[model samples]
Target: MRVALFTTCLADTLYPNTLRATVRLLERLGCEVAFPEEQTCCGQMHYNTGYREHARSLARRHNEVFHGYQAVIAPSGSCVGMVSELYPGLAGTPAPTYELTEFLVDVLEVTDVGAYFPHRVTYHPTCHSLRMLGVGTRPHQLLAAVRGLDLIPLPESESCCGFGGTFALKNADTSTAMLADKMRQVLGTGAEVVSAGDNSCLMHIGGGLSRLHSGVRPVHLAEILASTEEDPWLPETR
Candidate 1:
């Protein structure tokens, strides 16, 4: 199948490897992936911040940029949620979009993508992916099928990491408190890595973990699923 990669703004700017891994994973599964260069922010910030007109403009742009693809996949669930859930009202018709895990399990119909990651990893279901996209257990199913990955269950896996885009900035104290709780649970899992579908949430959690000097690494689900013995994903310096 031919797919268009919707590299969300956070992944494009801060987590390029996640996008690369997503492409690699899809290709390994016999998909032809294309990156539409004209794609930009999904205007989720504007929409969530009460700028409906600006959000609608970008929504129309998104429809135009990714018009002809068979499937549109993004690494971040937050952005996908914006497009799939809100675009219908903002733009006339919404593009067919799926989060990475959603596309992998539902569209591809394969849990074992021939990956191998021999580390204790826990998954955090971001608010958008969980509530908005309802990608329950798909990520877990994929991680379980990996060759050597030890998928640890995160305590309170569904709790928000306190990075609801502008929510972190506007409610700094509440966000930090929630993040502290999240970090504590992640640390309690004794997992070397904490994985999630959204880099924005990872960035928020990773920032707190870094400040605490905790060694728990925040990895994207695509990066983990993209790993194989032939070309193992080496952790970048945090």
Candidate 2:
């Protein structure tokens, strides 16, 4: 299948390896993945911040850039949810967009993509993926099949990590409080790494973990899913 990788702005700017891992994972699954250099922000930051016209303009650009692909796949659930859920309410019609796990599990119908990562990994379901997109169980289902990987249940898995994009910046106090609770729970689980679909959320959680010097780090779900025994991804470096 022909697919376009919609590497979100955060991934492109901060986590390039996550995007690379996504491409590698799709190629491993026999998908012809293409990266449209024209693709930019999905206008999520503008939209969520009440800049309707600005968001609409970027949304139009997003539609144009991802126009012809059979499937436009994104590593971020927030960006995909922004395109899939919010774009329709904007001006132009958006191309059908799928979050990476959804495209892998629902469209490709494959969970075990030959991934191998030996670590006590816990998944944090981002708000857009869990609440907005309703991508329940697909992520866990994929992680369950990874060889030598110990997937643990995150306590109160549905609770938000308080990284609501602009929400974090606007309400710093509330955001930090919510992050404190999330960090406590993450530490309680004794997980070596916390995995989530959205880098925005991971960035928030990861920063807090770093402050505490907890050694627990945040990893994108794509990075973990792309790993294999032969060419293993060292979680410490990732």
Candidate 3:
């Protein structure tokens, strides 16, 4: 498939490796991936923060940038949800959009992309991916198929990670409370690393973990899925 990558703003700016890993994983799976350089934020932040007009404007741009692709894929569940579920109402029609994991498991129909990560990793399902996109169990299925991965069940795996884009800024106290509880659950799993499809959530949870000086680190799902025995992310490096 000729896939156009919509590397979300967060991944592009703060987590470039996740974007790179998504590209690498798709390429390894025999996909002809193209980077739509004109693609920018999916206007999720604007839409969620009562800036409908701005978001609609961005939605138009999003449609234009990814106009002719067979599929528009992104590593962010929230961004994908905004495009696939919400964009049509804002703009006229959106390009066919798929979250990276969803495209991998559903479109490509492959769980084991030859990934090997020998570490205890627990997955946190972001709200948009789980509730909005309905990407249920696909991520776990893929994680289970990894060669040396130890996929542990995260406590309250389906709960929100408190990174609802502008929701955090609007309700900082509530957001912090939710994040605190999430950090507790992540640490409870005793996993060396926590992985999720959305970097925004990881960034929020990871900030709390960092402040607490916890040993566990946050990793993007694509980075873990992209890992191979020949090019493994060593435990010590994290």
Candidate 4:
């Protein structure tokens, strides 16, 4: 199957490592993956910010670039959710798209990932993805299958990380308040790293951990799944 990688603007510029990890993981799974350069932002940022026209143009561009691929997989729940659910609403058009884990478990049907990380980890599901995409427990299926990885379920796995695109800017105070609770939930788990598909949320959560001098770090799901015990950095037991 020909799969296209929909690396969003944030993942493309702010968190390039996540996109690279995605490419590495998919290639190892024996699927042919291609990067479509024309694809940029899924217009989620604009759409979520009340800019319908700009979002429409972005949605159109995204669909035009992604149409024929067997599946378009992205490393972000936010962007994938935008393309799959929100884009259709904005542009009155829909196309096949998969958040990385969804594609891995549903399409690829293998979760061993051929990579191992000995870290005790937790997953944070961004709001749009947890509800809009209705991908309940499927992402966890892949996380649980990784060899040597102890996947601890978060207490409120469905809570938002509070990075609602421009919601951060418009209501910074509210955003931080929400983030505080999310960070607390993550810390409560005592996991070394918190993993999630959307870097925007991880970016917010990671900043909180840094400000508090907490030991926990926020990592993208792609990064964790692409790692292996060969690094020797992984804790021997966790």
Candidate 5:
């Protein structure tokens, strides 16, 4: 099947390798993936920020660029949720977008991943995964199936990482406060690596840990699942 890669704005700007790993992993699995140059922002910012008219134009742009693909896959659960859930609420149409993990598990339907990573790992279920998409254990269902993973449980796994895009700006104080609790949980776990479906949240939480010189690292869900013991890049902070 032909897949279009929606790297999402944050991933393109900060976590470029995450998408690279995603593309590489897909190719390894014998799937064709394309990056649509005409694709830009998914218009989630404008809509979330209350600029409905502009958001509509941007959404129209996204659909126009992505319409031909048999399937569209994005690296961020937040972006996927915005496109799948919010886009319909706003535009009254179907886009058939999938979060990377959701796509891997739901559409691809293979758990072994033909990949491996020998690391102590923990997953932070992003808000879109928990509430918007109600993905439940579908992500976990995939992660646990990796060949050599030592998955650890995150305390209060449902809590937010405090990076709700503009929410971080509109309520910086509250955002940091919430993030503090998440960091506390991550450290409390003693896991070597933390992973999530959303890079924006990872950036917010990972930035805090970096400032404190914490050894724990943050990674995207795709990068973790993409790792094969033979070709491991295990999402360490770079």
Candidate 6:
């Protein structure tokens, strides 16, 4: 199947490896992935911030850029939620959008994409993926199939990491408190890494982990799924 990659702004800017891993994993699964350079932000920031007109403009551009693809896939559930859930109201028709795990499990019909990551990893279901996209068990299914990966259950895994785009900045105190709770849960798991579908949430959680000088690392689901024994994903320095 041929698909267009909607590399969300956060992944493109801060976590290019996640995008690269997404492409690699898809190509390994016999997919022809294309990156439409004309693709831009999904205007989620604008829309969530109450700039509906600006969001609509970008939504139209998003549809225009990726109109012809059989499927539109993104690594971040946050942006996918924006496209699939809000785009209909913002733009005329919402693009056929699916979060990476959703496309892999539902559309592609494969869980084990021949990945290996020998580490204790816990998954955090971001608000958008859980509440908005309802991407439950899709991520878990894929992770369970991964060779050498010890998937530990995160305590209160569905709780928000307090990074609701602008929510972190606007409600800094509340965000930090929530993040502190999240960090405590992550540390309790004794997992070496915390994984999630959205980098924005990972960034927020990672910041707390780093400040605490905790050895735990935040990793994207795409990166974990993309890893193979021959070409393994090296852990980032804390």
lDDT of each model, Cα atoms only?
A: 0.93, 0.91, 0.89, 0.81, 0.84, 0.93
Task: List candidate 4 stretches off by more than 4 Å.
Answer: 92-94, 230-238
Off by over 4 Å in 5: 92-94, 234-238
Q: Which stretches of candidate 6 lie over 4 Å from their true place?
A: 236-238
- Model 4 Cα lDDT, one tens digit per residue, 101-204: 78887778876787677889999987877877777777687788777788888988787777788998898999999999998898899898898878888889
Q: Which consecutive 10 residues in model 2 have the weakest lDDT in total?
A: 229-238
Task: For residues 54-97, write the lDDT of model 1, one tens digit per residue.
Answer: 99999999999999889999998899999999999999776689
Worst 10 residues of 5 by lDDT: 86-95
Q: If the candidates were sorted by their TM-score against the true structure, best first, what order would they fall in?
A: 1, 6, 2, 3, 5, 4
Residues 1-238 of candidate 3: C-alpha lDDT, one tens digit per residue: 8999898888888888888889899999999999977877888888887899999999999999989889989999988999999888999788889998899889999988899998999999999899999999999999999988888898888888887878898889999999999999999999999999999999999889989999898999999998998988643243
Kindly report which residue stretches of model 2 are placed more than 4 angstroms away from their true locations once superposed. 235-238
The TM-score obtained by model 6 is 0.98
Residues 74-104, candidate 2, lDDT per residue (tens digit)?
Answer: 8999999999988888966687799999999
Clash count for each candidate, listed in order shown? 0, 0, 0, 0, 1, 0
Better of 1 and 5 by TM-score: 1
Q: After superposition, how far is residue 125 of candidate 6 from its true place, in Å?
A: 0.3
- Model 4 TM-score, all chains together: 0.92
| Model 6 C-alpha lDDT per residue in residues 193-221, reported as the tens digit of each score | 99999999999999999999999999999
Cα-based lDDT at residue 133, candidate 3: 96
Best by lDDT: 6
| Local error of candidate 5 at residue 222 (angstroms) | 0.7
